[model samples]
Target: MTLLDRLNQDMKQAMKNKDKETLSVIRMVKASIQNESIKLGKDTLSEDEDLTILSREVKQRKDSLQEFKNAGREDLVEKTENELDILAQYLPKQLSDEELTSIIQETIKEVNATSMKDMGKVMGSVMPKVKGQADGTKIKQIVEQKLR
Candidate 1:
């Protein structure tokens, strides 16, 4: 089954189980996927495209969660945390720091990026390799640490 199919099945399950929070997040995800499809003038998105969208949704929720926590908005934090948890189910397994470090090292060598000026080249090469498996912010930090 495709990711969309799985999401549809889970959405139905959430509805049947009366899980309002899960249902809300799933519906939001579906809506975003549909919006992207509409933008591209297509009804179907590739697996990679779906993964990219899912990652974007999770990142957004994580950002909101952090903001809510910092502002002492416990109510919003809890709700965002729940949404993050629901979204996490669909994201690819995250990379370990060690694994990410190694990949960055290899990418630097492959791209021959020896200075900060080469940072963009390194990032461009690394992102495609780590897209779904790693967070871009974390990868940037690691690459910065390595390049310096």
Candidate 2:
């Protein structure tokens, strides 16, 4: 099933099971996707567009989790963590470090990146291939290490 379809199916299951937390997270994601489609004047999103929205939601959840931790709000942190878990279920599986490293190496070669100055070229070429699979921060760290 498509990601959107999976979200809808899961939302229905959550409702049937009376899993309020999961339901809420799925609803938030669906709303965000719809809003983005409207903004882009599209009837539906492509896979890349959907991945972008999902990543944005994940980022928001992570940011909120950190803020709650900083404020020493145990209750809020727990809730945010639960939401993050639910949202994360929809994301692509993360790339293993070895897999990520190989892709980085290949990208560097593909871009003919010999130094840090070509960081942008390597990153631009790599990101599209790994989007929704590798974390951006991890990719950058690997690229920097390789360039150094």
Candidate 3:
């Protein structure tokens, strides 16, 4: 099913089950998707566009979660964690560390990146391959470690 359709179905279920958290998250995501479409003057978004929006939402939550943790805001941290969980359901399965490492290694070789100076080249080459499947921060860490 399309992401929007899935979201709509889940929204209905959440309402039936009185799941405020899920319902809220779904509504927010739907709004984000709709806003993106309107911004781009499109009536519908492609699958890649949907993934991009979902990825952006997940990244925003991750950043918030980290900030909340650093600030020792346990309540916000917990809420962000729950929101991340909800967002994750719409994203593709994340790459395991081993898989991500292997992909980075291959990309590094492909780009003939020999040092940290080529970090951007390696990242540019690898990001699209992993896209929504892996966190950019994690990818950067692995790329740095591999290059070093």
Candidate 4:
């Protein structure tokens, strides 16, 4: 099934199971996807578009979680962490360090990046491939290390 189809099925399942937290998170995801579709003037989104929205939501949650931690707000941190967990369920599995390193190496070669000056070229070429599979910060670190 398509991601949206699966989400709809899960939403129904959540309702049947009386899973309020899961239902709420699924509703939020549906709203976000609908908003994006409207913004793009499209009837529906491609899988990639959905993935992009999911990635953005997860990134926002992670940022909020860190901010809450830094501010010593345990209550907020706990809530953000729960949201993060819900967001993560929709993301692709993360790349292993070894797999990420290999892709970075290939990307550097593909972009003909010989030094740090070509960081942008490598990043531009690699990020599309990495997308939701790898963490941007981790990929940047690997790219910088390789470029340097």
Give TM-scores for every candidate, taking all chains together and pairing residue i with residue i.
0.96, 0.93, 0.97, 0.94
lDDT per residue (tens digit) for residues 1-148 in model 1: 8889989999999999999989999999999999999999998999999999999998898888889989999999999988888888888898999999999999999999999999999999999898889988899999999999
lDDT for 82 (candidate 2): 89
TM-score of 4: 0.94
Q: What's the ranking of the predictions by TM-score, best on top? A: 3, 1, 4, 2
Clashing pairs in 3: none
Question: How big is the positional error of residue 12 in model 3, measured in Å on the Cα after superposition?
Answer: 0.7
Q: How well does candidate 3 match the true structure in TM-score terms?
A: 0.97
For all predictions, the C-alpha RMSD in Å is 0.9, 1.3, 0.9, 1.2
Q: Over all chains combined, what TM-score does candidate 1 have? A: 0.96
Candidate 3, superposed: residue stretches over 4 Å from native? none
lDDT per prediction? 0.92, 0.92, 0.94, 0.89
* Runs off by more than 4 Å, candidate 4: none
Those runs of model 1 whose alpha carbons end farther than 4 Å from true positions after fitting are none
lDDT of 4 by residue, 8-123 (tens): 99899999999888898889889999999999999989999999988888888888889999999999998888877877878889999999999999988887889999999999
Query: lDDT value for candidate 1?
Result: 0.92
Better of 2 and 4 by TM-score: 4
Clashing pairs in 2: none
Per-residue lDDT over 1-148 for candidate 3, one digit per residue giving the tens place of the 0 to 100 score:
8999999999999999999999999999999999999999999999899999999999999999999999999999999999999988888989999999999999998999999999999999999999899999999999999999
